[model samples]
Target: MATNVKVIAGDPSQGRTKSSPFEHPYALIPTPSLPTDGSKPHGALLNAVEMFLVHNILIRAINSILYHAPLVKLHDDIKDFLHFCEVFVDFTNLHHDSEEEHIFPEWARACGQPDIMNENVAEHTTFHAGLQELRNYAKQTRDDTTRHSSEEVIRIIDSFAPALTTHLRNEIPTVLQMQQYPNGDEQRKIFAKGVEKGAAQADNTTQIPFALGCHDAGFEGGKHRFPSLPWFVIMGVVWWYGGTHKATWRFCLAICIVGQRRRSFEIVVSEHTRR
Candidate 1:
């Protein structure tokens, strides 16, 4: 749960490296560290910021897939790619739903600021339509491979990427600002409960594996510890559950069960190709 991690920008121009594929083709949002000193909001609010940062990593991974994956040459790989896109849409929607349903209301009540999170809510709306369109496109393509259009998928992402990324990045500071209130302990409990409720509703089989696949355990010299599942869950449950969509998980930057770093999936048609 180390929170002092800095943002890492994985430039595709650097070519394939020994790093985890999750870290490539985009800039990751950095998680702000909790102050060791007796800071006002040193507890749950900071932890929420950390979790948001983790989600941002996955967000960037989906963007990487859109830009870096060799969709045209993929052929059979397109099936898994479409499935991956579906998983991305599912995870993002669930995260936002959980925030709106469980986290935001509670925070507003506790801080006596009902409209505090309205901006974030509005931001979600800005990207909702485009995200749904991408979801529909991915599902349609999955059902009928002939419908697969990499260009269309990229266009949909382009339409929403600005608003989506803005919301993702802006929410961190808003969470941090909650420290101005003297209810760190209470805010901590609210956030923890929201996370628990969200986790309880997630699809362990697909969403869990998809998240682990995008996470890099060795990030920032292995300082960050995210998705803090036990070894048993990682080795046993994820290993078996991910079997349902093994092909889709293969496109993941890290092994779905274990966060081992590997090269991201990409196709190099010519020596001068850069994506």
Candidate 2:
């Protein structure tokens, strides 16, 4: 299947002194467009809204690592970089877990088709080992510090990124297919409830802030407010929680605060070196 992928380019005005070699003009996975027509199936549209918002964050996080990995100094910068990778792994796992545990089962039951989500579950197996390897590498490197290798990090991601991204992109259309089921309004409610439950189960202290850090609010002309939280939560709560690992969060392509404007994609090595 043809997939639309576009590389995220860093704006020169965002504080970078020179163009990053990893900033390809057009090679990253593009977020699937949500439907606007009122006549469209509401269930599919709602599913698209939820899936696209989270999927875009996942795509950006992956691209951020790909764009910045080569710039990291293995010995001096590996600590924070590995933490960032670990956060990525955690967030990705949480999303898939939510789907498998909450969203997929609910949707299948609602549709009266136990196998509706089987393909997605199978796709998870394709990248599960690679993701686990990444998590293990990050933890091991943090303990030893000497085993860190930027190339090895990138190599692990490369092994699974294609399959991982393909699953991310394809699942959008599969969810959209829920439009064909009867009782559209009821299905939408079911989806919303599943989404809410899944979100409530997350470890807000880490996963929430990690997701905020991954999101670029200015994406696609800045029309959406994702993971939409109250102003106080974003400014007061998320800001406080995100500070727990201040240095590690810096590798994120965007800030974790509300209105997450673009920041330079370069990972700072000097700060870690100083410590």
Quantify all predictions' global Cα lDDT against the true fold. 0.68, 0.69
Clashes of 1: 0
* lDDT tens digits by residue: candidate 2, 1-275: 22121224366353332454323321434555656684564676666766777876677677767766776665535677788888889889878987888778878888888998899889999998999999999989888777777789889989998899889887877887887887677777776777787668766666777777666555555666676677566767566666676556666655543334346454444422222
Q: For model 1, how does the per-residue alpha-carbon lDDT over 1-275 read when each residue is reduced to its tens digit?
A: 21121123343334233553444444567667656687565665666656665666566556556754443344445667777888888888988899999999999999999999998888899988988988888788877786677788888888887788778887777787887888888888888899899888889888878777676655554555666667566767666777777656665655543333333434312122235
Clashing pairs in 2: 6-28, 7-27, 7-28
Once superposed on the true structure, which residue ranges of model 2 sit more than 4 Å away at CA? 1-41, 74-76, 257-275
Candidate 1 error regions (>4 Å)? 1-26, 36-41, 72-75, 257-275
**Which ten residues in a row are the worst by lDDT in model 2?**
1-10
- In candidate 2 the C-alpha lDDT for residue 34 amounts to 53
Q: After superposition, how far is residue 236 of candidate 1 from its true place, in Å?
A: 2.3
